[model samples]
Target: MKRQLVLVALTICAVLPVAQAQKVGETVATPFQGFAHSAKGSQLRDQVNDLVALVRAKRLSDAERKAIELQEKFEASFDRKMRQYSFQSKEEYLEFKQSAPEQFEWIDWGYKETLQMKAFIAADKREFPTALSILATIEKIAPASAGTAAERGYILNQLGQPENALAAYKKALSLSTRYQSQRPFQAAALRGIGFALIELSKLDEAEAVFNDSLKIEPANKVALNELAYIRDLRAKR
Candidate 1:
């Protein structure tokens, strides 16, 4: 009986790191609202949706190609718009952004969303290095994005770097607190922290964090499943 219990506990721990990996699809399916009002934006949105469909259909190679093409197309569109403004230099563009924040806001949001989709696709393919590189670009473009931090946490967790994942998840939670638009991701960040804690053999803390996640999103299947696993493990202990 003792040996059986130990084996069961070991199995649970072995599977803990991957509890959230399958949730990546739901993250990828999240729609971008930045470009919803314009015709070009609508086209870009459809392209992103197509990419998501490909990913969901398990066509990672197609998704990767589509992601690359979308990035190039978006860059071309951005450049065309910038040319219309006749900005002489990066400094001029920065000044214009500050002077006409409203005009620049949607563009910033669209660019960030496009980069985020690319990162999500890379992550879905289990291309951690590529995903991290794309996320770095997103960080440079939008440092305050809780979504980026949450993604970093998820990738780090998959890399078996629980300590780093914990920090990234914490940063995501902090950013979510400050950014109203990011609040929706708080439950996910909490769940990430819980998963990282589990990998670190901190089950008590992990249980608490998972509970917190459940409080935010009562229907979160990941959190519910993890909480059950924790209880089963503890009972065996």
Candidate 2:
């Protein structure tokens, strides 16, 4: 009887692991999932278009405007994520794997920094608190981010915290977004400064800054609109 009991115990132990093998479903981030649930590339593309359309529409009421602004701000970050399974700059990136392969996760996360800044600006324009939250998140992601402080400054300026905003923008402007000259990218940093000046209610200074952005990017809609708007305001006077 003791021998029989031992056999049964061993059998039960052997089966226990299998019984416990049922993995609990991993909880996925449901962010923006309500817009569309399919993870298919085409589906996501469609959803993004829909989102852009909603953002661009001028028909929104004040409350709707606020909501759309918040959504668009969060989206700016998504534009920068260069999805890949390896580092962006192969030469500089591969050195990490050779020296510290254990720490190296082979994933190319490229250029999304600027996108985050734009997103934070969008969100903050709608709701100040949300922008603050996004800024904190950017700081955590890249402590020494070239554009992080600039983005924070923009947000603070919008929130009526001009002193803090100035500090943030100064920090950001000092940090470099180093790369080859490009219309869209070059305009971003300049635009940030221009808008920060706007927040400070320095209209003349802001107009000049926008002009700088336009010089680098003649087709930049933001700078054009802002310059035109300022001129219109002046014309009315």
Candidate 3:
């Protein structure tokens, strides 16, 4: 049973990066035609499009390499455009947020997506600390973001900090309830909480959490497999 649990951990560590990369592609690999049609921002749009293509092509290592360079470029360009707005005070920025929601969304989404790519790249490299740091920045930028908190839980779990991971997963669950758009994220967060409970040796609690996750996502393979493992553990006792 212990050996099987260890294998489950190893399998999760191996599969998660690929799954996350696919999610990143799905989230960001949309057509960029309307995003930045002007010549001034066309280069940035092209770069993003190319990166998305690379990810979709399964050239993730190459994509990760390109993403590092693109991160620097995007930050500089975004900063320049942000400077052009010249919000001199908090009130000015808040008013802009309210008055130009589309513009705010464009800038915010671009920056957050860029950071998310970097975070996934770092996670692929097994750089949990770096991934967590990037996610922390993302959380600050998008305070109510869903995946940011959940991904932090993933990194913390990879780093073998189950207690902290549990807290992060619960935070993700809490935030997810306030937003109904991403049911998969909420389900994933619940699975994360179950995994953390297992790590803490709270097998019974983990079983219940896994059942809860399965309730949300009946097709969640990870939760189903873990629940089976939990059952095996109990059957032996």
Winning candidate number (lDDT): 1
**RMSD in angstroms, candidate 3?**
7.2
User: What would the TM-scores of all predictions be?
Assistant: 0.67, 0.43, 0.68
Q: Where does candidate 3 stray beyond 4 Å? A: 1-49, 79-106
The order of the candidates by lDDT, greatest first, is 1, 3, 2
TM-score of 1: 0.67
Clashing pairs in 3: none
Q: Candidate 2 — which pairs collide? A: 73-119
- How well is each residue in 136-233 modelled by candidate 2, as lDDT tens digits? 66554433343455556655655677668656655554543431211113355566666666556687987987898778768967677777766766
Cα deviation at 66, candidate 2, in Å, is: 23
- In model 1, which residue pairs have backbone atoms overlapping below 3 Å? none
- Model 3, residue 128: C-alpha shift (Å): 1.6
What are the candidates' C-alpha RMSDs?
9.8, 22.3, 7.2
Q: 112 in model 2: Cα distance from truth in Å?
A: 7.0
Candidate 1 lDDT tens digits, 49-95: 56656655667678678868877776666644432222112332354
